[model samples]
Target chain A: MSSPERSSTPMALIVVAWALVVIPLLYGLVQTIRTASALFTG
Target chain B: MAVPGFLARDRIVAKPGFNRWLIPPAALAVHLCIGQVYATSVYKAALVADFESSLTAIGAIFSIAIVMLGLSAALFGTWVDRNGPRAAMFTSACFWSVGFLVGAAGIATNQLWLLYLGYGVLGGIGLGIGYISPVSTLIKWFPDRPGLATGMAIMGFGGGALIATPLSRQLMSLYDSSYDGTAATTPSGSAVALLFVTFGLVYLVFMMFGAAIVRVPAEGWKPDGFDPSTVKSKALVTTDSVSAANAIKTPQFWLLWIVLFCNVTAGIGILEQASPMVQDFFRDGDASLVTAAAAAGFVGLLSLFNMAGRFVWSSTSDVIGRKGIYMVYLGVGLLLYVALATVGSSAVWLFVLLAALIISFYGGGFATIPAYLRDLFGTYQVGAIHGRLLTAWSAAGVAGPLIVNGVLDTQGTPGELVAGDYRIALFIMVGLLAVGFVANLLVKPVASKWHEPKSQTSPTPERSAAR
Candidate 1:
């Protein structure tokens, strides 16, 4: 028997979906580092 | 129901009669390299000295790598299962090698961000993908002894640090002392670059072998001498199978997540400050450099125990039930942390022994859970579920170090200078372990509602058609 379709999002849309997830994660990481540096240096 | 490009169920499950043994060694090779995370401290002093970075700043690099490991693994899990281990393993090796190269570049240029980008993101991705590649395949190949099989593979993951710690230390020393220049203190940049490149190339070759040899067993294939009755006798869950989708919806998945989260967090509290923690407890006004080296050796000793636990304790889970094994891990672990908190370093040997046991259980918990998942859910889509569950690891990677380091940072003085400095952190670990114990207790045999009863009820089409 074949595995059922697990994703309905198109391949292109899936790329966008990943980008959406990854970009926010990177942004938050950058902000954390910046904030940490400021606090420690100050 | 066959999806295009999906391996036939029979093919996916079929036993490759001769090649089964090759998979674990492949897993070990990759694990030995990724295990370098345990030896990160070897570079910490160098990084601080060269870049003028703080302890917390250097720690952030490691934290980023760990957090990314879980995240990338979750992202890559489904792809690994669908595409097979070769693609995933090769990709992991490439990324890991690139990460090392980038890290070397960072050191040469004294650029911190590039090091983070290379080692943290790139190497983390490799870690994530390489870690999961062999897990589901090994479980499927040895369904009767999944705990042992996955443990065999994952034990390598835990042990990787053991091998890496000593090797990295020696390499660093060789690189540092070989310098004949006027600069009396500074390690040669060329030596560091060469070491990184050497490690990267060696790991790439080793990982490629793992990727090449990986093959999924045929569907419904059992080992030639194995009996289902033997497996059932061990008090382990023996389900016909549950799809990954169904498994995720069950409470068992979430409970397992909590158990892992607590176990990892508790262990990391000690692991993050192992060197300092040891020196603080046994302060005798020795030279600072000597004390630091001793502490580093203690860290390496802990790595050995961590590695051993991954194999020995997890293998034990195959005979005892997973829940029963976890009860020991959590219960004993809680007592140990509590003892460490209240005893105030009076019985130093006792402290070391108990801490080692707790750390071993932490590693064991990681090694055993893949097999546990296979037991609760069937091989089908178990990789995906395993991937989703790794988010717990990612969360704990952040939470564990935070609890330990954050407390130490707040305390602001060596434990020797201030009495009971680590008492609060030890108590926190005890509390976390208690939470894990409760979570383990709450894990009931997965409810029948989650099982793929429809698949079970259907006639064995292959058997019937053959007849």
Candidate 2:
């Protein structure tokens, strides 16, 4: 079940795919940290 | 014929140039949407008000969803392996979104059974299918780093609550002006109904995006500079593939099941009561030193640790090996429970730090199990095995809270409990972790008798590749 020769992928597409998921993830991380910080201050 | 042609296993095979990295994001899309299950607490109060129901009645919705998650995963696991990730993802999206829409109708009409059928049964099925969809694909793509690959995807499940909690709050606030995202206020049923519709639509887009972009690797593809033979050199790592049907017969699978059940059961002792537990620990005469807000913040902090551990500790398994990593999760976890029971209340920082580490280990156990299974059972039907294993989690979900809450109930009434009231429950968790540690120790490579025949197991050249 050997595959055919590998082909080159566009770097831009890789970056776009990653950013699509990462952006929402970062937003959530920031929100959680902001809420959790109250553990110390409150 | 039930599955569309486009969603077929063969149709979504990676082209020669397909970048393997694109797959993780696609996996994350579905995980993040279904992970909303954990964030159901955000709306628990509103549902109670809407139905004029007791807290237990409302809480049963979440319980039902979790129970169905286990059942559906076990029942459909082999079908998922046979059909492939795309079909599974699409099926999940349809079930999940329709569930929300049906739940919206339930809320709008004040019919509780519809909500139970929709979110609890249908949505739970989505959660089960979505949870395992990408696991085997990720393992195949990064056989050299299976832990890291699965970790990246599963981490989204933990992190999904981080997004959904705040997002749900904001959406509810938008839908109802009277609600301020606080305990003092509750959103109207109409607001919640609209919120479900919005969530249903949004999740449909994200999950469909995942199903559209996901691809299985080409047959026999390997990453540059990665030697498949080297993977077998690791302890308990198998080159041979086992069928999911055969996997359940092995003692190793049951051992890992116990390991996961104990780990999750112990973690939920803290998670199930995070808010009130912190307040009770620091109680001073009539009022606790910790405020309600701080207790909430502690829950948020635990969420961060749980999310971080899923990625960090699971990826570390790639270096340390899965068995070594689980020893740390189970062995050290037992001692941490002891410390938490004894001196955890002496200081707030001490309590937080101990619980955080335990929760991290808990998350690590969940994220690492797939890689562990891949090592022991091989990847022939790992997604199916993973689905089967998750029944342990469902069992733990019931047992963990029952043990904690039952102990607490016997100690004293809810609002009047103190640090002493919790010791018995915490100690019980310590005992559960001890059992898990021994289970982890007992796990070994599956016997050759359990392996699928080579002719039946081997991938054909035209078949899309799986690990």
Candidate 3:
């Protein structure tokens, strides 16, 4: 698993990692903005 | 290295060229899964009907898990540092998901104690281990910015709840066609069993992503262009090591414990009643200014602040020292509570802004504490210290709710109460924040007598020698 040939992280692993983190944060951000707007307008 | 216990160790170990940024997502995977514990309320009513139990009886499940989380973290934090993140995370995966599996069985068989034992005790041990598994490794890797590293990971715990709550509600609806996504309706017992099993299976894969990728830095590794001396120069920051055992003996430790306790007590006390509090604040005539949906929106807004503050304020502590950051959390927190007591009901915007800011500081307090521990103690047992410090959180979890509810009960029920009803509790929150403020002032650098000798700076597998 720690071979010299496998020096770089796989592309798939990088994509999954970014997706896992970025996706939820974006969703939460979008939802929060919506609620925040309502807080003032209400 | 060939042993079963260390199977994924080599796979996750970072090679020379590996980027440190890759680590946070791995940590996020584990945290997001366990954060589902906060989503339990979505199923509480469902379980109440399924098991024919009172809401208080069901609420005890989450309570036991949180208590166990504190205990297990304090107990097993050192084991995590010694054995490495992979081993600790894998063990966490087994305990956490298995706890859910056992809980599924309990639900199926209608055994309440089994639910308590399964989800409460076993899952809690998993939460504690899972919570701290990445902390030591992340700190060691990013010694340049310990606050940012630990905050990124701890932030996930708060974020996890956000993801789980909606997902669980949707899943419950899917499982029981009759569930209309409301509080009154309970999903089918079989559906709950299925939900438990699904969560267990999903979380295993998610947590393993972290376990499979997490690696400790080699002895004395530092990031490019990072100055080791600069970190040391920051106020009250140190490279001096304190054993987790000795750390507790230090006045700094108790000071931090009280600091964390008060901050948490105030925040959790308010947060536990967020939905109800919003209605209580603005309720006037028969038709209150704040409706249920608006109240829910306010709760959602607070959750966002709660989660984001974990990353934003804690990371800010890297630039502004941990002590300064906590001063803001406590000092400003006291002011906000006062405003909420005196002027909160004057305008909806004022109430919302103050509550959100207070929650952000609360989240910041949690994420910043480990780095705070690192500054006063050192990395050698920072995870363990962080674990022990979490007992403050468990204590606050109980005390916070008690303070809020006791006051609220005497004032009036949730909907009938107005801002006046909350004046007493809000003042108490101010008093609690002042205590934390005083504790922060008392914290100074640890004494030289406690420092680990220079030769033993590198991590050792031996627990007795390591701390």
The candidate scoring highest on DockQ is 2
Best by lDDT: 2
Candidate 1's C-alpha lDDT?
0.70
What would the per-residue lDDT of candidate 3 be over residues B1-467, giving only the tens digit for each residue? 22265544334556666777778887888888888887788788778989999989999999999999999999987777667788888889989999999999999999999999999999999999999988887888889888898899888998887877766777888998988766656688888888999998989888887887777665666898999899888889898888888888899999999999999999997789888788877877756788776887788788888988999999999998999999999999999999999999999888888999999999999999998998889898888888898999899989999998998899876667887998998899999999999999999999999887888655666643345
**lDDT score for residue B22 of model 1:** 54
Q: Please write out the lDDT profile of model 2 over residues B174-264, one tens digit for every residue.
A: 9999999887898888988998999899999999999988989877778889998899988899989887877888899899999999999
lDDT of 1 by residue, B60-161 (tens): 778888888898887777666665566667788998889888988887888989889888889888888888877877887787778888787787676565
- The alpha-carbon RMSD over the true interface for every model, in angstroms, is 14.7, 1.7, 2.7
The regions of model 2 sitting more than 4 angstroms off are A1-7, B459-467
Using alpha carbons, what is the TM-score of model 1?
A: 0.81
- TM-score for chain A in each prediction: 0.54, 0.82, 0.69
The TM-score leader among the candidates is 2
Q: What lDDT score is found at residue B122 in candidate 2?
A: 92
In terms of lDDT, the poorest run of 10 residues in model 3 chain B is B1-10
